[model samples]
Target chain A: MARRQAASAGTSANEAAPPPEKRRRVRIKPEERYREFVSKAVELFAEVGFDAGTRELAQRLDVTQPLLYRYFPSKGDLISAVYKEIYLDRWKPGWSGMIEDESEPLRTRLQHFYEDYTETIFTPEWLRIYMFAGLRGVDINARYVVNVETDLLMPMARAVRRELGLDPDAPIRPEEVELFWTLHGGIFYYGVRKVVYGFACPIGKEQMIANAVAAFLDGAASVMRGFAAEDASAPTAPSTRRRSPGSRR
Target chain B: MARRQAASAGTSANEAAPPPEKRRRVRIKPEERYREFVSKAVELFAEVGFDAGTRELAQRLDVTQPLLYRYFPSKGDLISAVYKEIYLDRWKPGWSGMIEDESEPLRTRLQHFYEDYTETIFTPEWLRIYMFAGLRGVDINARYVVNVETDLLMPMARAVRRELGLDPDAPIRPEEVELFWTLHGGIFYYGVRKVVYGFACPIGKEQMIANAVAAFLDGAASVMRGFAAEDASAPTAPSTRRRSPGSRR
Candidate 1:
């Protein structure tokens, strides 16, 4: 038959397909494997919240518990590693990258930043740790907090200045940054309170996200305009979702 | 001598302020005692959060464990009662007082609403229970979340219409009430997040609170203005907290 003839032409039927080449042609580096482990931990954190089982976490990774022990010595170490690799590393770099993109206008970039902030913080894995650190008696205010220079606030300020063509040394004042965060907080806190207290949020989730972005830009723009002593003289009311083509530079 | 003379004229110095005259003020309605017990629970909820000792709660209240049990069957019940009283009763009512003040612009009233949202949700008792509910695995998506009606969204919409004096039903929609919750959410979540997982927040607590509020108002105004589609525009950029002069109205 045709099948027999094809098999005979390719290789002997009794001979196996050379045992899948005995090994991977491209090997996984230790860094890659370690990243894989931490990535799995993110899902585990979401599943059980911050203080759930490490043994279960290891089980989820398809490795024996001792094998996990080989990489991490303590629960604290594992959690800290999870915080560093999965949450901080993933978000911080992306934030800086967006801010550094000089081609995009400040308003658009700000919208992009809000999109990132809302998405990253609200997602289950990060949100789990975000909520857990407080009540569990963790000291989020220690030297570790001060060391976090890469936070969104500073990056945001830098981006604002960069957009305005200000010198690097001439970043916006700390008060301006503070103002931005304060307004930013109202929306953020509302979303959070709903989550923690188990309130069925009435609004559509998509609108909520879009509003967070749009409102943030509006407020921050107000702040920046106020900085220059520019008054928004209104013959006008503003729209929530649609931007005016005339307002764009 | 003069300071001591006033007390000696009417009462002994040793008399502890005559305990507010033991006459009961209100009728003993159903759940009155339950309400009193919950008031104490709110005090405790504010102090140690929801999960600490019931025996300690009894000791603090100077009652027997059995007596405490007679009023409420369990600690969770006591905690739930506190939530029902504090969060449930006044959420809608607070707006009724503010929105009816027709002299003020809707935007000013909206700002006032945001401020009250912060005070109510961020305080000790409510914040503690809010967390407890989350930790206890209460469903956030439950229908009973907050239990306020869609009527709340109406005031702002009406305010926007009257301020610009638009048609009762304009072609373009006014701001959705959904924006308000999202605005509240983004701010509240940061507070909880700071407590729960300070590791993820790049900014300090004080700064986060301030910035988050600014973000909320900015977002709210932005969404509102965007939706209103006003021919004239409010200054979008403000670098400082410029108090709205009309907020005094």
Candidate 2:
């Protein structure tokens, strides 16, 4: 009875093993597979845009269509994952601290921060994907802009005020935000012109950043002095109450 | 014989008239048709982007695919036509003269110029197509940027210098270019954020432009003063010789 059972099991194993080499698949762990899919998908999306078909992506990934579906159920899901990785995950933790460190000259801090920041976000992939999202009318670009304005530009403006010997805790002015956006947008446009639009900037990136930072610092100091002069000249009315304790009237 | 000929002609005419309504085609002049095609194509391209299929555009125009092909040999040709119409054709000839008119205060000149300029290019269609062309890696955007810098910004920088009692014919400084770009780019980003990216700005368009222009003029004057101070303090090196007759060393 034992010999008969062993013979039956051996026959079933042989049937299962027939043409096994052709049917075998590489066994990637599920977590590893999901990450690989996102990485490859980002490249493909950045190359051809988010509208590229899954068949092309699957072909690029050298995987079956079903395999891609197993990782990301829909194209939108994949795009959301891509946005998270590109916008959210890529931001460095120490960037805010770098800008706020007060020990370094404002020009050096700005120049260094932009050099590092641009290195992370100013690639063709980042700029193209950003424009792609904007053109597609996705809110991702707007949300990212808000994040930059609030987290980066706002703090940088306060830092600029501090560096210029103004009260850092003063209520931020619209002109201050606009000025920061000018410097930030000017530098960002350098990337847009170079990476997205493929224009050759007459100046290299480092020199451009240095020049922009120097001009910004100089301009900010002058603007602040003008503000002080205006305050001194204006009649103090009841409406002239300061919004912040440390704010200049 | 005449009666028989008339009878036969009437019989043929009667036969031709049976489906006359269905067979008749609108007799649009070729020039009119070409203009109509271009106008419609711009709207469609601006709406859906350059990657939109020709068939879809033809459908939108209520014409056949062959008719569109008759007007434009290829999609690329159609896009070129769109670029020419949007970027080149829309520019007003009087804009440079407006900026160069130093009789008016520099603030008024800049304000008027930008208002007119933004009205021409800040529509959803123009901004969208501009971004689309940029993302598609087309030279339209780069060419447009160059045109704007040359026609608008270079002259504006000289105007600012003139307003500050500096020589107008001086060789343009990189700082001047970058500063003008900051102001120009800051305003442009306002349109991009509001119209293209659909972000709500804290201020209205007119207010934003007013703030940006005021900040720009003030910062520019400040920057010029700093340059003058630096020039006064620097050693009279041979390399510091003026490149232009109006330039200061």
Worst 10 residues of 2 chain B by lDDT: B240-249
What are the runs in model 2 whose C-alpha is more than 4 Å off?
A: A1-27, A64-66, A163-175, A221-249, B1-27, B164-167, B173-175, B221-249
lDDT of 1 by residue, A151-246 (tens): 555666676656554444443454555444544554455445455444545443444545555566556655555443321333133211222111
Candidate 1 segments exceeding 4 Å error: A1-89, A117-119, A141-150, A161-171, A186-211, A228-249, B1-40, B43-50, B62-67, B89-92, B115-117, B139-153, B167-175, B186-249
**Per-residue lDDT for B173-245 in model 1, tens only?**
3235555555444556555544433334444444444444444554555455555443223335322222221
The interface root-mean-square deviations, each candidate in sequence, come to 14.2, 11.8
lDDT of 2 by residue, A44-76 (tens): 888778877788888677777778878777778
lDDT score, candidate 1: 0.53
Worst 10 residues of 1 chain B by lDDT: B240-249
lDDT of each: 0.53, 0.73
Give me the candidate number with maximum lDDT.
2
Candidate 2 chain A: minimum summed lDDT over ten consecutive residues — where? A240-249
Interface RMSD of candidate 2, in Å, is 11.8
Q: Compute the TM-score of each model's chain A versus the native chain A and list the values.
A: 0.56, 0.80
Candidate 1 chain A worst ten-residue window by lDDT: A240-249
